[model samples]
Structures are given as C-alpha cells and as structure tokens.
Target: MESETYHGYNIWGHAIQQHEEPHRPGPYAASGTITQNNRVIEASGVLGFFDTDEGAQQAGLEWARAWIDSHG
Candidate 1:
C-alpha cells in the first residue's frame, strides 16, 4: 500500500452515476460501456490483471462473470 506506481487500464464505458459522497472519492473506475441490455456495467480497473492485451481481455471477460450473479 506504499508505492508511487499506479496500475490500471484505459477502457471505455457508460457511466450511470455522477453523484459522489462528500469528501468521498468516486469509483476508481466508472462504466465505460454498459452492455447486456444495460444489465451489465463495464467498469475498468487494473486489479493487477494481465500484462498483455490478450491477457487483459481474458481477464476482463473472467471478471465479467460476476455480473451474471448480480443481475440474475
């Protein structure tokens, strides 16, 4: 938790919420593209994911699996 290195990804999605709590930081990543009939929110973050593009895509897909449970 002590480092100057910032790790993350540059993706796109649709943001649903512009509201922010007072003195509360907004989400590290906001929805860039809301797919799945708006049921799925694609918020992007590093999460210390894969190093390569292919790996990151796979990582994103894997992380997306959780949305099924939340939306289902």
Candidate 2:
C-alpha cells in the first residue's frame, strides 16, 4: 500500500511495503504507521497481515490518536 497522511499522521503500509517488510511472507498482509510533523513517531513495528489495507490503515489511525491523547 502507499503511504497516506491521515489526521496529521502518516499511515504507512501493510506489508508488501519495503520499509514495513513482511514478517513472514504470503498474502493478506498489512501494517500501519503514525507520523507527526513529517516525522515517524510511532509505527506498527511488525507487519500486521490483514485482508485489506483499510483495516491496517484504520488500526494505524486509532493507534496514532491514542498515542497523541496519552502523550499530549
């Protein structure tokens, strides 16, 4: 998946992505990332294999929001 900016955060990928490399291999893979001010502050860390990019991105958004709330 392509990196997308969501709510001031960058939702990065779902496996298949070079940076969020697949933990194992196969299909239905995914990942997520959170960025602020153009800097990656949080990431899924491990590639979360999902059936769809939407799911991955959604998770990422949720994570980013939670982090921001807790940290801020």
Candidate 3:
C-alpha cells in the first residue's frame, strides 16, 4: 500500500497479490481509494492487473490522480 495527499484529499494505492495456480503467484491487482478529512470519498474496485506490485500500485495512483483531476 502507498498513500499521498492530493487536493486536500488522501489517496491510496494498493496492490493485492493473486494466485493463478497452486503455489504460483499471479499478477497484482490495482485498486485505489480517496478520502477527505478521514471520510471516504471514493474507492475503486480492481483497476487492472500488473506483473509487478509496484506497477500495479503506480497504476492505482495514476487512476486516483486522474479521478481527482476530472472530478475537481
């Protein structure tokens, strides 16, 4: 999980590990959440999957930033 503040709102990026087969790690799921004053503003379901956890997290962050930009 990673977090940052954007436009006075708190944004979070998460990477959820997945399993594709027995004893094998699958891609990471990207998700994000946005909050203001500790109150939930928006939360996204899985945005997509990526090969690396960092990639997924960055995708989530990018999605969150775009959301904020469009919504503002």
For candidate 1, give the lDDT of residue 17.
30
Q: Which candidate is the best by TM-score?
A: 3
lDDT of 3: 0.88
Q: lDDT: which candidate is best?
A: 3
Q: Write the per-residue lDDT of candidate 3 for residues 21-70, one digit (tens) a residue.
A: 55544478899999999898999999987789998888888889999999
lDDT of 2 by residue, 1-72 (tens): 556665666656554433345564434445566677877787665545555557665555555566666766
Local distance difference test scores for all models:
0.35, 0.58, 0.88
lDDT of 1 at 21: 52
Model 3: which residue pairs collide?
A: none
Per-model TM-score versus the true fold: 0.37, 0.50, 0.88
Clashing pairs in 2: 14-30, 14-31
Residue lDDT tens for model 1, 1-72: 111111222223222232345642433223222244334345545433222434444444444444434545
Per-candidate RMSD, Å? 12.5, 5.0, 2.7
* Model 2 poorest ten-residue lDDT run: 13-22
